[model samples]
Every structure is written in C-alpha cells, then in structure tokens.
Target: MTASQDVLGEVLADLRAESAELDGLVAGLPPTGWAAPTPATGWTVAHQIAHLAWTDQRALLAANDPEEFRREATKYLAGPDAASFIDDGAEEGARLPQGELLAHWRTGRAALEEALAALARGVRLPWYGTSMSAASMATARIMETWAHGTDVADTLGVVREPTDRLRHVVRIGVRARDFAYAAHGLEPPAEPFRVEVTGPGGQVWAHGPEDAGCKVTGSALDFCLLVTQRLHRDDARVRAEGAEAERWLGIAQAFAGPPGGGRERRGAPAPEGDG
Candidate 1:
C-alpha cells in the first residue's frame, strides 16, 4: 500500500516519542552507568546507544542517496568477514566517550528524521534486506528504539511504562511472521494465524483471518518483547493455541537479519513493563 502523508506523520510522531523516552533514560547516566553490562551479553548500555546512533546514520544515508549507499553496502559485504560488520561497527562506535556518543545519537536521529520528512509520499527506500516505504521505515525505527531502550532500562534496573506507542511495534511483528520463518531457512506455514493483542490503552489490535485455527493472544507489551527478541518466549504471557502459532512464538523477530538466538530464560530479570 502507498504511504499517505497522514499515516507517515503518525509513524514519525511515534518514532519521535520513542526517541524522547530513550533520551530521557540515558540523559543523566554517569560514565559508570554507561559502561554497565546489559542483558545482551557483551554489549554495555553505551553499546546499545552507539548501535542506535550508527543505524540512524546509515538510515539517513539510505534515504538521501540510495545508489551511493548500495555501492558502499556492496563493498562492505564483499569484505572477508562482512557478517560481523554490525557487531564490529557497534564495538567501534562504543569507543566514543559517553557524552560524545549521546550527542552523536541525537544528531544522527535528527538527520534521519529530516531525511524521512523530505521523502515524497509513497517513496520506498532500500534497506539492508528489502525496501520499505517511508511509513514502514519510520515504524521500524520506532521498533528498534523501543527494543534497545528496553535493554538500557534493564541495565539501569528501571521499569518503563507501557504506552499505546507499542501499536506500531506489534503491527510490524505480526507482519514479519513470514519473514522470521524464512530467515531460518524454513518455509512459513501456509495457514495464517490470528493475532490478538490487548494494547496498553485498552485497545484490541487484531490481524489476519479471525477464524484461523492457530492464534496468538496476550498483552501487547509481551508480544513486542517476544518479537524483538528482548524476552524469552517461555517468560512471556503470550499464548499460542496451535502448532504454527507456537512455532511463531519461539522464533518471532521484528528486525531483519539471520534468525537470532533469542534471549535465554536465564532468570534474566523480566522487563519492568506491563504484563
């Protein structure tokens, strides 16, 4: 579907809101806090923010100059160990001082916001995997911001509040069901499963055929955590009624990449959000 200005505007507004929340979370962090280890194994809080900043920079480039960005991506992919580029880039970025990294993140975020705003309606931009309309891209950015923001919150031992903002994230997660299976070199189930999430605002968000035998239902926050790989499926309240739906819960991922080894049930502290 073509992106309309109003839809894009709403997505952008959500993106900004997610960024503002994360910005507040880290604005007062001391050096030690920035270096504190998070649940993502080797990544510290600083690495989380740095990774977001680096991605924002790349997204800005993709929006403004697709051809140039593709050329660079091709070259980067041709490197002997190119699969490590994301991890390597995050490590390299994490070397900056906390203050500098925060500043860079803010600047990169603004640049990307501006670049997206300038795109014409219905415009699609190239990403690491497939292309996305401006609206879709904005939603993806919001999803990432929230996902990483949770890691930051976890590291600080702070609880975040659930908001209606998660609607965007949940939508992307449901939409990405097929992609998640494909990433694992497995064929997606032919039957579509119904998804019914009760959002924080008391709104019920439903997708797919309502009569589908397989179904997933639960709190929107839990579903978002599941799709983002932030919480183990066993730790979430989300229920999958059928085999296909259960499989989806086990392997769901919102962001594009190789199928991720999801967060383990290591007695990791549950994210302090809605149940």
Candidate 2:
C-alpha cells in the first residue's frame, strides 16, 4: 500500500482501538464517577463520551449530506435555545447506563469507520469550514480521541501508554502550528522546521525538512499531548531548540479553526530540551 493508505489504515485502527478502550474504561466506572468532573472544564466523564458519540453522528450526517450538516450546525448555533439544545442532548447521553453508553459509543465509532473506509482517497467531506479528505478526517479523529481520552484517563488515574499510531496526532499537531499562530492574529513564521519524536523500539518519527530552520525533539507521547493541548507546553516532556522552533512551540495546535485559550497546566513547568 502507498504511504498515505498505510497512514489511513493505521489511523482507522487506532480509532477502533481507542473506542474499545473507552468502552472498557467507562464500563467499570461507578455511578458517581459518571458525574465526576474531569480535567476538561465543565465536563464530566459522561459528557466526554457523549460528545464523542455526538461528533461521530454529525460526521456521518456530513458525509451523507454536507448541506444538511451545515444547516443543522448553523441552526443550532443560531437558535435562541442553543445552550439548552446542547445541554439536553448531552443530558440524554449522560443518562445512559455504563453498558448502554459503551455500546452506543462502539456503534457510533464503527459507523464512522465504515464511512471512512468506503471513501475514495481524494474525496473531500465538509469539516468545520473547509473540506478534508478521508485520510485527513481519520487523522483528526485520532487526535481528538487520544487527546480527550487522556482527560478521562487522567481523572481516573489511568496512565495510557503512547502507541505508534499516535504519530497521526503528532503530524496533525505539526501541521496546525500555522493555524495556531493565525488564530492569535500573528503571521506564522516564514521559516520551516523539523519535528522528531522518539517512539517505541527507539524509532524516531521525523517530519519536515531535515535541515529546517528549527527542530523539536522529545518523546512521542509528550509531543502528541502537547500539540493536542491535553498537556500544556510546560507540562510536556519534549524540548524544542532554535528561535523559530520555540516560536512554533508557542503556537502549536491539533484542533481545527481558531486556537482555543487552551487549558492551564496547574503547577507544571515549561517543557525543557531542544525544539
């Protein structure tokens, strides 16, 4: 298979694996823990799971009919009862028992995977504002699952090991550096940079030009978490070096659209090492 196809396959696999992991984790949660606050502000464990399911359902709708997807999203955003609408949906999802909730999560994820698997390589689906191919969409899903899953795991004191598939999340994060800068109304640095993450078995996953103006180096997991905003820059284990690299470090993002204010690290120190 081509490199892109390989990456697509890996992303799909990771999505499935993560969905399963979330299912198992939620299945064991006590009723009280369902309403327990997670690291994600104003969201309990149930809210997180429901958000995933809702997002997947939206994606499926978008894939089938882009116009309908846009209309619904816009209507929801513009409605007088927008807050109540969202709250009601989430509340309905949160009310599901652990077993039913997990089953719903699995079903939604499987449907999304099937839709992605059926798409042609070049086909684009409406996402946020622009269009993205199946591969890009899959990559985005991987980043979201891993990042949000970290929040759940953190609240429960579960340490999830970094997987090789997390490279997709890292790549998305690297690509989003420019968007992060733009969100802040700053012009992205003109110079390019190199990103290298140490993965399992001593494998080094590097992206961008080898001799780029900047270099970011650190563990794959740290790099993924940092870029996804699951962990703050200071809280990450990765180190970046060079002026341009440091600039990119300050504006890295994985999510689409304008950059968020981002979560605080509480008492974490800025990540050390080379960019």
Candidate 3:
C-alpha cells in the first residue's frame, strides 16, 4: 500500500538522522579501531559498518531494480553459502580498506535514500521475508542501524545518548510480538496485548487496546533493547501484567527472520553481534 507523503517524509528524515549519528561515531575511529572486535562473535567494527553498507546496497537494488534484485536473490538463495549470506556480505565489505569501505557506505546510503524517496505510487519493495512500502522499508533501516550501532558503541565502551528516534524501533518491536512467537515455533496469542512504554523524551508511547487483559509497561529504551535482542530479558526493567505478555517479552523481536538468540544477562559477555 502507498504511504502518505507527510508520514513518509518524517520516517525518511529519521532514517537519515539515525544513519548519520552512527556514521559520525565510526568516522572518527582510527585504523586500529576498525579491527577492534565488537560483541558480535566474529565481527569487528568494520564488519558492523560494512554490514549496514551491504544491506543498504541490497535495499537500493530492491527499490531501484526489482527484477534484478529478484534474479540476484534467487541465485543467492540457491547458492552454497545461502545460510551464511548475511555474514558473507559483511565479511566481503569488511575486507576493504577502512577509507574505501566508509566511502562505499556513504555512497550507498545516499543512493538508497534517493531510490526510496522516488519510489512510484503503489510500489511495494520486495525484501527478505516480506514486502514493504517506502516508509516501512525506511523505518526498518533505522531499526537495523540502531541495533548494529549499539554493538559498535559497546565495542568502543561508548554509551549512546538515547533519542526519541527509538520510537520507530519500539513500534516495530511491539508489532512483531506474534512474529516472535511464530519464530520460536510457538502459537501466537489469540488477542493483542496492550503495550505502553516511556520514551527517552519521557513520553508514554502506547500501542494495542487500552482495555486488553494482557499489558506491558516500562521504559521504551528497555523495550527496544529487548525486542532488538541487544539486551536480555533479565537485564531489562520492562514489566508485563499477564502470562502471555510476559512470555512475549522473552521472545520479543523487531527484526525479521529467525529468532535471535538474545544476548546473555547483563553481566555475561555479549554474543559477538546483535544480529
């Protein structure tokens, strides 16, 4: 379905802001910093940024040339390395010189933005596991960017200042509640649960029915971290009022694809990457 111009503009703007913030963080890193391992098992900081760039290029292709994307995707899925495709892409980009890789990411990001903004009416871009409108695609980009950026930040021992942009991530997390259950081979709840979380700006963002029996309430930041699988359930301070809601929190996921084996408890060493 087509998205309203006003809302699409807002999401695209947020996408740019989210990308730029991470770009700024990595742009200042020295060459050695690129080799420094992030929490993701085998990914260094370079791998993290490279993954974003690689995915951005794929998105650009999906938006600009669907026929080619489908052909390429078919070949990819049928290939021997299909299971490792994501990691393989990151590895290929990670091998480039830091300067070259950075430039590649910058160019790709710009082109993707142009493609998404210019998408024709009634066009829904095909993506792995689903299709999405320009706005949905852009919002997903922001979500992934934030999730991976968290890994980079953790690697550098930097604590990013939370922002209201997390609202996009939060929205996805809540929407994906059933996807989480299905991903885990469990039956989805029959009814939706009420979700309310306080954003970084101290604004309460609420979703689902107000009178729903199952309800979740807590800090938006914690919920985002939980859904992204960046923070373990035990480490998050979010609360749930019903059994279904509580169970959902344990498997909450905003990103598409297989269930992410979430990071270990707060004190445990984090898995190599958030993805």
For all candidates in order, the CA lDDT equals 0.87, 0.75, 0.89
**C-alpha RMSD by candidate, in order:** 3.5, 4.5, 2.0
lDDT of 3 by residue, 116-230 (tens): 9888766899877578889889998999999999989999999999999999998888877887898889999999899999998889999999999999999999899999998
Error of 2 at 262 (Å): 3.0
TM-score of each: 0.94, 0.85, 0.94
Candidate 3, which ten residues in sequence have the lowest lDDT sum?
Answer: 266-275
How does model 3 fare in lDDT?
0.89
Better of 1 and 2 by TM-score: 1
Instruction: Provide the global lDDT of candidate 2 against the true structure.
Output: 0.75
Candidate with maximal lDDT:
3
Write model 1 residue lDDT over 1-275, tens digit each, in one string.
34487788888988999999999999998999999988777888888998899888888988999898898788877887566777777888899998899999999998898889889876788887678988888999999999999989988989999999899999999989999898788899988889999998889999989999999999999999999998888889899999889988998999976665568675754342211
Instruction: Output the lDDT of residue 213, model 1.
Output: 95
Q: Give the TM-score of candidate 3.
A: 0.94
C-alpha RMSD of candidate 1:
3.5
Best by TM-score: 3
Q: Show how many residue pairs clash in every candidate, following the order shown.
A: 0, 9, 5
